[model samples]
Target: MIFYHFGKYILLLKSVFRRPEKASIYKREIFKEMVDIGLGSLGIISIISIFIGAVTTVQTAFQLVSDLIPKSIIGSITRDSTILELSPTICSLVLAGKIGSSIASQIGTMRVTEQIDALEIMGINAPGYLILPKLLAGVMMIPLLVIIAIFLSITGGYFAGVASGAVTAAEYIQGLTTDFIPFTVTVAMVKAVIFAFIITTVSSYQGFYTDGGALEVGQSSTKAVVISCISILVADYIIAQLLL
Candidate 1:
């Protein structure tokens, strides 16, 4: 079953990456998708990122209750944890649910309603027309979102540390500036890109081949989210192993 689906996914990807019929039309579609997927998602991302960073700081501070350890380590720990794991992974997971399900349902609905068929009747490469722009948008915008998430998460940690009296503002700033590795940012970007691709492609595949009616569309959406999440985790582990 898995192999069958994987093979279909590969074939769909080949179709999606074909040359555009009209560069102007494709560009317009790409911009629209970027706004829909990126700007539309900012509010939820901001809320989750702030709370995740704050909680990480509080929890890390609580765990390191030792006189031998410097209080500034709370900031360092929170910074590293947020950048390395929390921001990219958690945010991608949230996006997989939000963006992935939307893609699946949108495409699935079009498939069921015969819109895709109508495009084909007009001599259009329906898959390329429908899915390519979304793929482009996902890859371009998700990394940008992750970058924003990283900054907001670190800021949240700083505020939480200072407000909780777990660490002084000066100590947090010092820790944040100390021993920062540029490579971690690269890893985060790599993860973000791979996750974005997985979310877009997997969900699109689920929707593109959807069978039956409205009930099936809902099923496809749910399946897309589930599959995208599992793919993200697998890709996350692989990227960490290779990059870190």
Candidate 2:
């Protein structure tokens, strides 16, 4: 089953990357997908990121019982955690449910409704036309969202620390700026791009081959989310091992 699905995914990718028939049409589609996937997801991403950061700050502060460890370490811990793991991995997991499921359902609906067939009948490269724009948009927009998420999460951590008296504002600010490694940001971007591709391509692949009606479309969406989440985690581990 693994090999079968893997082969199918590879074939689907080949079709999805084929040359576009119309550059202008493809550009418009890419922009539309960018709005749909990126802007549409911002609210939920922001909300989740803030809470994740706040909770991480509280939890990290609680664990540090030793006086030797400075309270400023809370800020540094939050910053590293948010940028390295929480923002990229957690946000991508959430997006697997949000964006992955949406992509699956939307394309699955079109497949079931024969819209994809119609495109093929018109001699269009249906996979390229339907999936390429989404792929491009996902790759481009998800990293941008991750960057925003990283900022919001760090800000949330700062607010949480100050409000709860877990750490002073001065200490938190000091921790944030001290010994910051630029490579962590690079690692986060790598993870974001990989996660974005997994979410878009896996979901699109599920939807593209969907064979039934509305009920099956829903199943595909759920499956897409599940698979994308797993893929994201696996990729996360691999990227971390290689990069860090």
Top model by lDDT, which number?
Answer: 2
* TM-score to native of every candidate shown: 0.99, 0.99
Clashes of each: 0, 0
Error of 1 at 219 (Å): 0.3
Worst 10-residue lDDT window, candidate 1 = 70-79
**Model 2 segments more than 4 A misplaced:** none
lDDT of 1: 0.93
96-137: candidate 2 lDDT, tens digit per residue? 999999999999999999999999999999999989999999
RMSD per prediction, one decimal? 0.7, 0.6
For model 1, how many clashes? 0
